[model samples]
Target chain A: MNCRVCKKKAVTAIPRHNTAFCADCFDRYLMDQVRKTIKEFRMFEPDDRILLAVSGGKDSLALWDILTRLELDVLGYHLDLGISEYSRESTEKTRIFAEKRGYRLIVEEIESEAGATLPVIAESTKRPPCSACGLSKRHLFNRAARQYDRQVLATGHNLDDEASRLLGNILHWQDGYLEKQLPALPAEGGLIRKVKPLNRLTEKEMATYAYLNGIDYVIRECPMSADAKQIFYKKILNDIEKESPGTKQFFYFGFLDRSQKMFPYSPEASPPSEKCRMCHQPCYTDICSFCRLRMKLSPFPDPEQFNGTHPDVISLHTED
Target chain B: MPESKEQNPDETESVQENEPRRRAPTPIKVFNAQTGDHLEVPFQKRVSSLLLELGIDSETVLVIQKDSLLLPGDSIDPRFEVEIRPVISGGSGR
Candidate 1:
């Protein structure tokens, strides 16, 4: 097939958009999409320094490439969960990519910072692996942004990630999570502003872009997420999307347009009234979840004896 | 190699003389990037049909042939090697 714009040879097809593009056109199209998404959501100012949470995956790497191409002031941040060889390889890929592109990168190892890896934390606390990891990553990402003086934190979450997450939240009637499913979340409380530039792009598109742009990334999934519910939701959504080309986009973008406003999430309704005694971070209780987790890992007294709250609800953040 | 007990020289010669000689089409070698499995399948028709035969959803993966993305309606040449890369990712970033 010929390119939709240049009338040359096409390299990829976006079925949902009903158009195909050559390599040069697709790259331009992706950059334009990122710029449009940023402008539409008012994600950040051009002068604002951004800290990107990259996992050495196609989405984040592609986003980094686009942002750099756009000449935005962006630095890459990677959190090593210390998942044995996986963490090592992931870190290597991120570092290599950054070095090759002359992009500054910061690597934080969870084991060194928290006195334990993600697997250890998950096992000791009996929390779900993903939950523990997510909470830790969120805290660290925010902390890193603050430490580095960056105003915005960008992640590699694509259309499939958000759509599947929305499906899971809707399936379980997790109303609280619905409000948090936007392309941009303003910096509130101690949380750094989070933005997903690739939210409008699909995983296939991201992968294709990475391939065409020669961006090397880790192709394997996290070993801990073998049977994650997120994967199942994605599969179900893909089945629906195959039958209806634009259903995934409609379901997610439609929520942002109309349904999201119906279920408003007001952070002020129950803000972090108190600060954690340990880390001085904003939290509802004396100690934050990250501090509580560290306390559990340490030889100190049990945190439960003081806060009277269970370990599962250690964090002030509520996850679906 | 042992010869088949049911083999008949006269019958084989007669069948060979009557049937037209036609070479079988080469099968496309597909590599599943997610599972790291190698498989071969006939081109059949388009990318969509090929994915259907492999029991993979077209939405979840991009079919790559000679480093180019193939559309569902794009016909793949059997001589080319194809790679099926799954785009679905989950859990926390490692």
Candidate 2:
């Protein structure tokens, strides 16, 4: 059968869609989008070491495959969130995949590094575990990259993720967040430059790429992420995509194509403050948020007691 | 961290007037604040707490004040009204 999109000789039959793409064309289409996004945004320099945040999921696995195929100097960084059996399997799969491809992989277990598991953290904080997990992942990724002297950290975030986040930012009119959501964030004094090469590809495209490439990855969702807010936005975007086949692409690429003319870059904008006392990463406060939260989760004073009316609120400080 | 009383007398006087003497500091109201449960802490509290609250390093949230952005190490006058805006994801997608 001929492929519907590329009109090439079909490889395997796509179960539900009843259409198929030739292996070469399918890989090319996905990789081309990534390469275009990289070039369009100048995501990386020729000599920079890129730490690819791989989650042992299709999106990230596909991203690593493409980066390697493109001959980009890249390594894989996976955060082990310690989600019961699921996290262990994902970690092992990610490790094996990286090792087979001769790629360097850095796996950091949160339980070991922070001495707290996700469930424990969630129970103590009353906040969803995903938010804390994301924060820790980001914090550790940047710190690891800096330690390795890698100048760029690449993530598997694709077009769907980008569009969902865009919608969230738009709903709240979060200018600060919107400003930093560009494809390529330049390297500041303390931060390693971050890029999302898969920003142009859709979730479907990534899944297809992963399957076609025969990359081993975990298909299960994080048990803790079942009720995440981002999941709501993703579902909304997915519904929109079902109604409009290329809506996600149109939204994200449209922004990328017109961002320079439509938005004036803020000159006074500085990289986030890196003065976190605990982590010594860039932060606006003396102690980093991760450390503070960890401390809060530990045997510390109650946060509710600190709440008071404005004017008196300043006097409320956590007694160390 | 220096106590308010330890600062220079001239600086201390200026802060003393603005300092919250009887109650917790009121959140500097922004027009149409972001939705969700709005817990408005003082700019410093928001910054300090959010760093831990969000489990993010301090550099993730950018704080702009007094025509200059404060670094993590930079000393900020608690008296100055600080704006708490999250540095979020960006692009042109609607």
DockQ of every candidate? 0.42, 0.01
Instruction: Output DockQ, candidate 2.
Output: 0.01
**After aligning candidate 1 to the native by TM-score, how far in Å is the CA of A242 from where it should be?**
1.3
lDDT of candidate 1 over A1-320, digit per residue (tens) = 78899998888888899899999999889888888999999998768999999899899988999888888899999999989988898899999999998999999998866678988988988988898898888777887898999999999999999998999999998877786778898887777788998889998889989988898888878888998999888888888877888999999999999755677666654456776765556677777787777767764434453353433544534563
DockQ computed for model 1 against the true two-chain complex using alpha carbons: 0.42
Model 1 chain B poorest 10 in a row by lDDT: B85-94
Q: For residues A190-297, write the lDDT of model 2, one tens digit per residue.
A: 878888888876665565566557777776566676666665776676666556656766787787677667666875567675566445678766656676666656
Best candidate, DockQ-wise?
1
Model 2: per-residue Cα lDDT over B1-94, one tens digit each = 8665566889879988987779665554321111213343444444445344444333223344564334333444555555433322221110
Q: What TM-score, over all chains together, does every model reach?
A: 0.86, 0.68
Candidate 1 similarity to native, TM-score = 0.86
Candidate 1 i-RMS: 1.8
TM-score of 2: 0.68
